[model samples]
Target: MQHLLGLYRASERDIALILQEAAVLKPALLSSPPQSFSFLNGKTVVLAFFENSTRTRTSFELAVRRLGGSILNFSAATSSLQKGETLLDTIANIEAMQVDAFVIRHGESGAAEIVAKHTRKVVINAGDGMHEHPTQALLDMFTLHETFGRLSGLHILILGDILHSRVARSNIFGLRKMRASVSVCAPPTLLPVGIEHFGVKVFADISQALEQCDAAIVLRLQLEREAAGFIPTLREYNTFFALTDEALSKVSHKIFVLHPGPVNREIELSSVVTDRDDTSGKSESLILRQVTNGVAVRMAVLKVLLYDRA
Candidate 1:
């Protein structure tokens, strides 16, 4: 694959290769002995993020550094995009500098694809509007498989703004490809039209969704949706969709919770689950593990993209 624009086009073998590479690298790179990598040696990767980010950008940077690559963080706010320079023109200018690859995050859907078409370098979509976050889904899948030892036959419920979450969309594409059952729960307004066409059941009630799924991937409310009046209020949204302490207390089975955060505490998830992330293998939250796995998955992705092999 010349570019990882979304999971919708990634072959099942491609996904497995990345996950398997990450499984091997995670322990080796994160261990006490800290086995290092040089897959990115003598290569320069550009972080061209048009939107604000925390985990994705940080983890990608750490992943590149760990692989001995040089970093160039490009901010759209400070770049010529502010002065009416077209997106393609700006990307062309950057491409002319001989960068090896681009990690792009943009508020516009298909932005990465456009950049890829204009540039000769490999493009990894960190995120693209509400379309997809491929690496996030890869890392999320790695976390799920690492914890459960398998993804087949496991029911994973994605709870929250499916209409606006790139992470949720990517996860749906990836999990379904891996033969895992997927479902989504959200307020009527927060759910997109024909989302059921994605081959996942849609539930208006969170409790019903939780009851059927083995793991819940809770998503944060898109603040943009609230401003556009997608829902009645935060309190009302929380009442229907929030994974609160009281909500999970009723489920008898062992179910885990994951979030691609900046979590809205007491909203998407309560403090009880978010605050008690532990290493005892008993904490319901796999939030931090997702963050840690992000780096390894990104490293594996770079290895594959740059070297064309895992």
Candidate 2:
């Protein structure tokens, strides 16, 4: 439970404990003047992000501050990386300054693992290039647990740009570890090779994938990394892959919808379906819940990795 490189590194027991801790911490966070935990009172954590981010970076900063830990924001642009210092050398320089943990998001895959190998401090992978976003998966799992009350026997549909989504990879690992059935729906170009070997049924049609599913997680299309001719057009992709109000109507039973943030207006999910919610106003409009739970889940990870639980 030291460095969270990916969901594949975690056992089912480990996942359960992190989820339990997150559930316990979340209520305290929702308090009127949110209660401070201060578990990492004297520790220093460095947020080393080499990629642009909004939610994940902010959530981790809030998580650390809420727990009374000191954070040094590492900006790749302003740092000595521009001065030709090697990644490991830059990290070594930072480690020499008495940091306790490194929360990193890098454009390079295996960047966190490289840091983990070189540093004594804890390394929590915020994300790595098309590799894994482990905390996002944990928070998504927490959100799903809140909705379904259990992951076992639930058939979850992961819809959209699977080939480029680290979130998809992480979710697949976490969901399957908990005994939930997962199915992926994407355009033939968007679906990764050997994805079926991950124990998920792949579908070329979204409607067919949603038929027996209890919940759906719509993924944002990674247009930035996409090559020319990979997708014919945004209009064509939306016509088939977008989770719309019309699509949800086809499901016989009520089901929840989730999206990891920065959603394209009409690409991955439609506005109507995103706004729709259950009586408790929790199920369908779970994007904010996923964001909120992110802080709690990250808190649990930081506490577990940095503190002694004897």
Candidate 3:
């Protein structure tokens, strides 16, 4: 509970508590007048993003301001890392400057763990390379719970790029912790070795996978990881694997579609489903709702971590 490193290390009770706190904070923080709570009033958080991001970075920034906190946006490119300074040295320097916590996204797996161990300050992993994005998984669960009223017994299918997805790994950990049945569908190349040991069913056919699940978390094809010949070709992967409207038609019940975005409009899902006018903020895709909940969830997490709740 002291550090939000990864959901796999967190208890079911802890996840439930954070989600509960988010539910309470969401209404006021997202209201028309947008009430701001000052629980984090004097704390300073550093967004130590070593990798580029859109949703995760922006939402954390939004959450920090909404909670009346201060944030410093850190860039590895501009920092001493470019000048041969070590990560530990950089963190030591930042911690000396009134920083209370760090929300870090790094390109290496276990990088957050290294920082969490190095500093006494709270560490929240924004993301770690192909390891786990705990907050993204938490927010995805938050969106699902908002729509379904619960996580238990709801069969969720996580489709795509499993072997390289930190989001997928975290989701599998979290959803299973909440008592929800988790399954994955991906090309055999994209699926990880011994994934079933994590307590999930695996499927090859996307249609059959769609038939059994109530909701599907569509993952973007991690094109960055494709250089190692994980698949035959990107075109072949998209043609056969992408979650399209035609694929959803085979299922009878509504299969809520979600993607921890920067959605690949061309490869992961068709534009028709993602291109809908959702200005009312009630998109059935639940994509936009996930973004909104991210701020609330991060706010709840910051409140818990920085409030001396240990």
Task: Please give the CA lDDT of all the candidate structures.
Answer: 0.89, 0.88, 0.89
Model 1 segments beyond 4 Å from truth? 278-283
For lDDT, the strongest prediction is: 3
How much does each candidate deviate from the true structure in C-alpha RMSD? 1.8, 1.7, 2.3
Candidate 3 per-residue C-alpha lDDT over 1-310 given as tens digits, one digit per residue, 9 for 90 to 100: 8899999999999999999999999998768889987878888999999999999999999999988999899988888999999999999999999789999999999999999999999999999999999999999999999999999999999999999899999999999999999999999988889999999999999889888898889999878646888878778788778877677666676667799999889788878666644433222487888889999999999988987384
Two-way TM-score contest, 1 vs 2, winner: 2
Order of quality (TM-score): 2, 1, 3
Candidate 3 yields a Cα-based lDDT of 0.89
Model 3 per-residue lDDT at 77: 85
| TM-score (C-alpha) between model 3 and the true structure | 0.95
Model 1 lDDT tens row, 199-297: 999988777888889999999886666778998888888787888866776676656889999998987788887766664432389898899999999
- Where is the poorest 10-residue window by lDDT in model 2? 276-285
CA displacement after TM-score superposition, residue 131 of candidate 2 (Å):
0.6
